[model samples]
Each structure stands twice: as C-alpha cells, then as structure tokens.
Target: MTTERQFQHDSQGPLRRIVSSVFSIFETRLELIGIELSEEKERLIGVLFLGLAAMMLTMMALITLTVLIAIAFWGTYRWQSLAAITAVYVLVAIVCALRARAGLSNAPNVFESTLAEFKKDRDTFN
Candidate 1:
C-alpha cells in the first residue's frame, strides 16, 4: 500500500536517474563513434582506389615517355638522355618520399571527434 509505493518510488530515485543518464550518454557516444568509423572507412577506400589508379596511369605514361626520349636521341645523346632521366627520377622520388613522410606526421587523428566529445562531456560534468 503506502509503504510499497514509497519503496518503488525510492527505488527510482537519484541513483537510478544518474545511472540512466550515464547510459544515455554512453549510447550517444557509441552512435557517434560508429558514424565516424563508417565515414573514415569510406574516405580511406576512396583515397586508396584513386591513388592506385593515378599511380598506374602515371607509371604507363612515364614508361612511354622514357622510351620515346631514348629513341629520339638514339644516334647522339642516347646514353646521356637516359642518364638525365634517371637522375631526374631519383630527385623527384626523393621529394615525393619526403612529402609523404611529412603528410604522415601531419595527418589528422581518426578519433579526434570522439575524444573531443568525451572531453566536452567531462567538462560539463565537472
């Protein structure tokens, strides 16, 4: 009767409310993480595919141009032409490698949003 109702009400008091709020927070954070993960996956796949295609086409062009240059200079400066091409390729490759290394260091954190959200929640609770 009255005591039973009080018991039920007390059971659903601040502690229960706090637990429910925490669970809701966790649910929201989990949903955000899942959405971010999907977006990251899509972005990574697109970059990978596009990079591979570009590399393949550029390689073909390079081979064709190299052969054409060698053939054009066959009589006189053939060896010098090949040597110049080799040196230029080495320099370009070095520059590309350095730029890629720089890019890796500057790459954005994948979980930055998640961590930011978590920090916001913490600040709010504090």
Candidate 2:
C-alpha cells in the first residue's frame, strides 16, 4: 500500500474560518476601544489643563482682592490686628484639616483591592 498525502486544501475549514473570523472581530473591537480610550484621555487631559488654568486665575484674583481688603482695613486696627487675623486663619485651617480627615476616613480604599484584582487577572490569563 502506497502512502498517500491528503493536504488540507480547504481554506474555509469550519473551525479555522470560525476562529479567524472571531479573532478579526475581536481585533477590530479592541482597536476601536483603544481609539475611544485615547480620545477620552486626550479630552480629560485638556479639561484638566483648562481647569488648572482657571483655578490659578481665580486664586490670583482672590489674592489680589484679599490684599486690597487687607490694605483698606489696615488703618483701622493696631498691630494686634495682624495677630488676630493670623489666629483666625489658623483656626480656619484647623477646621479644614479636620474636615479633610473625616472625608479621607469615609473614602473608599481601592488601591490594594485594585492591585490584587489586576494581579489575579494577569495570572489567570497569562
């Protein structure tokens, strides 16, 4: 009996075609998703820059207004006025600090959980 070679001549074999089609679809979807994410990142970065600029401008205006008010009121009080303002500023800062502490305590701690989940997924897939 002569050995015969039977080549796989059908390029559209069911499983291979199906796998190729699925892979192409997945590739297309991933590409589209990447493009969307890149666009979103660009938009978010632009917004961050604009917000930073606005915050800086507002802070500058506020500082100028505060200086003007301070100068206007400077003649009414003695040197003790500066000390009193400093004390008030300190008190306000303490209250803000306390508020920030409370906020931090209430906020979700996601870093460790996120890292763990990321590692788990990486190991499971790869």
Which candidate number would show the highest TM-score if scored against the true structure? Answer: 1
The residue pairs that clash in candidate 1, if any, are none
How do all models score by TM-score?
0.89, 0.54
Which regions of candidate 1 deviate over 4 angstroms?
A: 1-12
Which pairs of residues clash in candidate 2, taking residues 3 or more apart in a chain or in different chains? none
Compared with the true structure, model 2 gives a TM-score of: 0.54
lDDT (10s digit) by residue, model 2, range 35-70: 666776797699889979987997797567657667
Candidate 1's displacement at residue 65, Å, is 0.6
lDDT for 50 in candidate 2 is 100
Where model 2 places Cα greater than 4 Å from the true spot, the runs are 1-12, 77-126
Q: In angstroms, how far off is 85's CA in candidate 1?
A: 0.5
lDDT per model vs. reference: 0.94, 0.67
Model 1 residue 9 CA deviation (Å) reads: 5.3
